[model samples]
Target: MLPDISVVLTTYNQGKFIKKAIDSILSQSFNNFELIIVDDGSIDDTKRKIDQYSDSRIKKVFKQNEGPSSASNVGISLAKGAWIALMSGDDISLPDRLQVQYEFANSFNYKICFGLPIIIDDEDNIIPDEDFPVFFSDHSFSNRKVFKRLFEKGNYFCAPTAFFQKDIIEEKNPFLISSLQLQDFACWLSLSKKYDMPIINKRLIKYRRHANNISSKNNNGRMEFEMKMIYKNILNNMTWELLHEIFPNQFSVASMNDKRCFEIEKSFLLLKQSIKSVHEVGCEKIWNYINDDVMCSILSTKYNFNYLDFFMETGKFNTNERDESND
Candidate 1:
């Protein structure tokens, strides 16, 4: 019989924490979930450790060296459950996690659900308040507008805490196979375009941070550049959407190239003149394009335009030059 949920726990060389991760899932209060562990060519003893688990619900697949994106896609393709939960081999799920999420998803009929995670060290000890990163404090997943703004600023959800229906995974092709560093972020952005990913509001997973983690290895300037690229793609899409809504007649007649070359002056004027209408259309508190300096820098550096010009042109802010300051 198929299970109610399929928990896809992807691992690289997390042999030290693999057993605990699997144990946490097996001990979940919600029992009808299959645990599929996809080992992405770990050079360590991760496979041997997984073999020690005799639980009939645990399904292990050993694949050749591939990144987490590919490994996750493999597990997703094999998932037979109605709901799919993503976890990392180094993370620990709270006992009531699956149950709470399952009920929440069913109650709201939401296709995607995610929650905040408690940061833990390699030794499984919770990090101190000062040391713990405050990632999602300002974001509200329940508010679609707030969530979209948060996503534009940066990825706020932890991948291991995400739970969604299998249909989203199949329909969206959620993970970008080529993205090595920000694949989860890319997936979340893709899903947000068409679905509402509500936050569970409870901490349901222990996210382990260690030296060997993929994120730790790639947390450099280049990662920021890649993230900016992702944000630009999202911005371009939003711009087109805004234009299509505000200038329906012109948008309908414009060629693709003409649309791309369309002056930001017109877009800015439309936004300034119809801010209320834009907000009513669900883009409440659109900050990134207006006030975010980092986003402005990305726009200036890549698209070769000064974002502050809009503020100056609209007399919104008394500034002569683009404020190059970033938060």
Candidate 2:
């Protein structure tokens, strides 16, 4: 029989911190778990450091240099527990972290779970900054509420604090390889679209802050590009029921009753949001949908915006306080 949980710790060249990360899980208050460490082509001493561990609960997979999404997928494929907890190579999980999250998810019957995080530095000192993840609530949210929050506020759920059922990983096969460094955010968006994950009100992980962190937004414009792609993908695939649920009163009740109309009406609200890339993508999507005469007629009849009206609104749109771009 398998362990109660499988901890898939995906590490690259985090040799310096990898031992502490592994030790954190090995010393978890909840010990009925297997730790699978996937070394994603670490050029440093990550492999040699991992070799120091002799714990039977610890398993290892050494592989070539693949991006984060690919490395994580490899680890997910090897998970043997009923539940899976994802830990980054550079961060440290508190001893009670597993116990608290596992119990919380099990008690509430939530398939996916996330915990709060406190940022740490290279010296393992707690850093006081506004960049850390905060869930802002003690209660759980419905899938729709969570989905809407994901779109409006961006990613508040930090990947290091992530925990979920093994079944979800199997069924969804999330963490798109095309998502680049933002696999977690994209996966969260995809999962939250269908499943309700809870944010436990406890601080569980010490998310390390350093120049080498892949989850860093400082990545060479890849973060922004991936985020745009993720948002566009979600909008393109959204059902009207979800769109209507996200924007309750934005669409008239009659429009809500009509799937196509309600779906098209989402572009209007997306265009009004304060996020630049999101609204830009929304504008692009509307233009794409309106090019066909039949869809144009449907949108024109169902909603007030026609081609010229939409053009005027798009022209007047400004997401930022300072509109410096000439485009």
Give the top-scoring candidate (lDDT): 2
lDDT of 1 at 203: 86
Query: Across residues 1-327, which tens digit of lDDT does each residue of candidate 1 receive?
Result: 899999999999989999889999999999899999999999999999999988899889999987888899989988989999999999999999999999999998889888878888998888764554444554455444543544434566778998999887644356777667678877776776667777777889998888454334235434544554554454444555454543454343333344323433334333443222221112222234445676455447545656465444445433232221011
- Looking at model 1, residue 260 earns an lDDT score of 29
Distance from true location, Cα of 62 in model 1, Å: 0.6
lDDT of model 1 at position 230 = 51
Q: What TM-score would you give candidate 1 relative to the actual structure?
A: 0.73
Deviation from truth (RMSD, Å), model 2: 3.8
| Ten residues in sequence with the least summed lDDT for candidate 2 | 318-327
TM-score of every candidate relative to the true structure: 0.73, 0.87
Candidate 2 residues lying further than 4 Å off, grouped into runs, are: 129-140, 170-172, 211-220, 236-238, 253-260, 316-327
Clashes of each: 0, 0
lDDT of 2 at 43: 98
Error of 1 at 288 (Å): 22
**What's every prediction's RMSD, in angstroms?**
9.0, 3.8
lDDT of 2 at 259: 63
At residue 111, candidate 2 shows an lDDT of 93
